[model samples]
Target: MTTRARATVTVSWPEANTRRLARQHLAAPAPSASASASPAEAVGAMLGAHAQVLSAAELSVGLRGDGLTRTDVRAALWAEGTGESGRTTLVKTFGPRGTVHLLPVADLSLWTGALSAVPTGPNLFSKDARMTPDQVEAVVAAVGDALQGVELTVDELSDEVVARTGPWAGDLVMPAFQTMWPRWRQVLHLAGHRGALAYAPNRGRKATYTNPGCTPMPGPAALAALVERYLYAYGPATPAHFARWLAAPKRWAAEQFASSAASGAIEEVEFADEGSAWVVAGDTDFPDEPARGVRLLPYFDAFTIASHPRERLFPGTAYERALGGGQAGNYPVLLVDGTVAGVWHQRRSGRRIAVTVEPLKPLPAPRLRDLEEQVERVAAIMEGTAELTVGTVTVGPHA
Candidate 1:
């Protein structure tokens, strides 16, 4: 097979088992020819940098029972204990542009500080944007008043700005300030940073803000530790990934990369197909064997979104559909021999699970059988029966 054909592997495994593996991979000190550690800790350690954010996404694909929307995905994470004690905490900010993501409790402070200190460049939040420091301060004050100690959504906060400052306050709102609602959130996501917001469960079984109070951002040392964690979890990675993840300038990420390299926190390896990605200090043992069967990955899973130059995991042709038109397309896919072969679904009639297979390319008979057997295993786990149809899977209401 061409290298592209062999880049990534998608397989079916229990969500709990996968998380256990992630923990195991992340915790081991370094890769060894014959190290004896449980797969659970290693997997956790692997995801520890992003705080197991990637693993949670993968979990959604396996257990959420399909037909997930964007909001549905987030809700799933929350249910799985988004930032809860035992689970990876999705720190409101850590990656590029204050996007909310899971971060390990251990590394929070370091990443938070590094990101906060980094200057926002030509981006809207940059020093010279429409909103000055005073304006931001005023807005913050108004937001506090409007919340009246209540939590609010981004929309609600924006509305308060309009009401207090006048209709034109809405109109005259600086582009940067306006952009900050979403964009600047990235700025705040630095390792030690925290928002003064309070979250509550909404009707849709997801988190909603009830209070707008801000949380204190972490101190310098704490932020540094967070950055170190990122290197540990996803190192050997290039500055670009770090830059995008933290919204930090490429230079800052580069500097961090050098520091991490010097400390032996991360290592780099170019793959036959996928190119180089940062692996943790001892993650050299990332499974090279073919992942057993088709894995239904949830949208936005970390492995899918892990880094740039993703040649290691996805082929050029697959992207047309996998990420159709640049929107992260969410398709149920088939993992054949450790690479994505096609998309699939499951149907239910009474007690049986009917699986539909739509292959991007043809498969050999033996491979097809392997896929069927794997499907049966999934069915057995879900329904206590191995009787399954693999030709065309879809989901129907429970009988």
Candidate 2:
């Protein structure tokens, strides 16, 4: 006998975007001085900000939290702990997709513990440059220990790591930006995901590494909770979408979603065209009004990267014009009414900024005014004042 399928709620793309934007603080900006939220908490609301280009990450967070400045974002990440346990409120480290992200220090346990579950990939380094599993283990241990009580520059960390492990750990064989990095550095993501190392504040021109000095919750529980959080933040999504976002294997992600659904932690729903997807068990409500606003998003913003159903999010010519060959976050976006309305670029000098926007369609006076205000806010996020220009943005991605 065949078992009956569970009832699934259907949601329109407009409704879905509305619900997601609300959850993400993109539907309406929260007053920064509401006495209810801090920058760290803002970062937490978005899960984490993609920080590969740290300045862009700052804009992503600052814009979501009205009145917040880039300085506020940095201070939240770099502030010293005043309480008995001296963990900074925010940490910059490897997060989802194995990319650098700014995560709240308090949630490091969840992120590290969850990320540790992502399966390791085969090494692509030259045979001689590769370290054996045993050697990798030794290097990871040494890197963690060397970082416990102090921060170390890559060069200094290299020396200690080599002394603690062996010369093999120091071999500059792993190729990087036209150069080779030490073999042991290959495990940097692994180290961060395991709660071993985190980024300390930059020292002069060099960045330093330090022990996170936090414990990761155990893997199984953390991984489950992570899936729940993702569903809450970006759900009505298939396991395939989740896999792509997490950089996890598709089969493994399928199992995770299945387990969550089986456990009643998430429920399946029918979302536009993607067939069935998952959302948090009780989070099916959506707003009647569409998400309406004018917002400027920075490169590699979390919203652009993680939201799904590409056709719906991209809409019209955005699929060809604004997107970088269909990938989100390569070019900064101009979002209006919860969809990609255009692309924008910013150039800053000293205390001034010039922002240019290219719209897919003509912006009415009201939207244009909103765009100017959005540009002003973005400049404030950069700690500058901006002049807005409505025309072609000739610069290429990340320019």
Candidate 3:
């Protein structure tokens, strides 16, 4: 048998920054267009928007497209999208990283299929709180059937699930927020991953669940596709980085890459000074120019959360200042010339938004002007005027 040579490309860290920014639609100005992109469309490209904080998620999507506002984002998500079929274009659910996200309806097939197959490592719940594989499937099926035409609050859904599965499913086993959660509720994200249900709108401060009406494509193929998507969006990455991003087992992630390499599903790159990384086969057009600009990324922004080479992304004092114990997305960051240069905070008052930036290092006069422009852009996205202040951000992480 003859082995083939995998096409390899050389990329410096600076070049990697350029390609990543362009892929994420942050390298240049938001393009002026006759038809504005829908929030779903914008989010679908980035995979999905981290919606742990719904307002922050809205801003995350609002900043990426041509003239999208918080109002537009909210409307697209809540006005029509419910767990039921044909409710909306976007469905709020448990997506990548097993956190809340706004996934596009059109791509739910891929999302659900891919997410269901991610290896679940280290079960966190007590033995009593955990569900057997068979029990989880039963709950997923019952949840899917119960949510077909009606939305249910968390309590209501719990009742329905327990009624269908009997008392063992309702045993309190998992600890959360100073309380124990039922065994059935432990699989809420699993249900979402299986196309059984998704998060519905809050019913007066209480979260609800509904059917997303999706059919999951669960198989090795689906998982492979997700790897491809990740590479396209955040490529030149290693299995270790991919594992961390998806919260999958490290060995399993490496197996996926190793098999893909053998099958030519992915190509290897000699990322300069960063060792070897992989890109989707045929995705080799790495930009030569370095990414340079100023941007304001809110808490849990995908760029900072999912991208790799963390040391490069959060260089110098940024690692200690912005990250929380080596975890990204705790503090909103200031991006200058494609790396974290500072931290910032924003306060909204009526039609005005006040922004305060604390630079880790001295920013040039031109960079300051660029940052001012970014502040104005953020204000526009929030439908207000922005005032820029280069003072200290008094608040702490996740504040």
Candidate number achieving the greatest TM-score relative to the actual structure: 2
Q: How many clashing pairs does model 3 include?
A: 2
**What TM-score would you give candidate 1 relative to the actual structure?**
0.57
Taken over the whole model, the C-alpha lDDT of each candidate is: 0.44, 0.85, 0.84
- Candidate 3 per-residue lDDT, tens place, 1-399, comes to 987564458878888777887777777556456434578877876778999888788888887788888887877777643345444677899998889999888889998998898888777776656778899889889889889878899789889989998888788877889998788888888888888888877888988888977888866778888888888888888999889988888899999888888788899888866688898988888776777789899999888987878989999899999999999999989998889989999888899888999999888999888988899889988899999999889999877
Clashes of each: 73, 0, 2
Off by over 4 Å in 3: 1-7, 34-37, 79-87
Cα deviation at 394, candidate 3, in Å, is 1.8
Give the least accurate 10-residue stretch of model 2, judged by summed lDDT. 79-88
> Which sections of candidate 1 miss by over 4 Å?
1-97, 100-121, 124-129, 137-149, 153-169, 172-194, 203-207, 210-228, 231-235, 246-248, 267-292, 325-332, 344-357, 364-399
In candidate 2, residue 117 scores what lDDT? 82
Worst 10 residues of 1 by lDDT: 9-18
TM-score each candidate. 0.57, 0.95, 0.93
lDDT of 3: 0.84
Off by over 4 Å in 2: 1-4, 29-36, 80-87
Higher-TM-score candidate of 1 and 3:
3
Worst 10 residues of 3 by lDDT: 79-88
lDDT by residue (1-399, candidate 1, tens digit) is 633222132212222122322433311122243543222232234342222233333343323233222233343334443445324333333343554444333334444444456666664444433554555555545554665656566566668656775453354323454453332222222222333342334436343453323344554444445555554544445677767665567887677666655676655655333355444455454433333344444345444454344443345555564554543325555555434466665555766656666666777887677666656544543443444434533432111
Task: Give one digit per residue, the lDDT tens place, for model 2 in 1-399.
Answer: 967486569978888888878777777544445533466876787789999889988888887676778877777787634443454577999998889999988899999989988887667777888788898788878989999989999899999999999888888888899998988888888888988898889999899999987788998889889889888888788899888888788999999988887888998888889878888998898789888879888898888888998878889899887788778888889999999999999888888898889999999999998888888788877899898889998988777
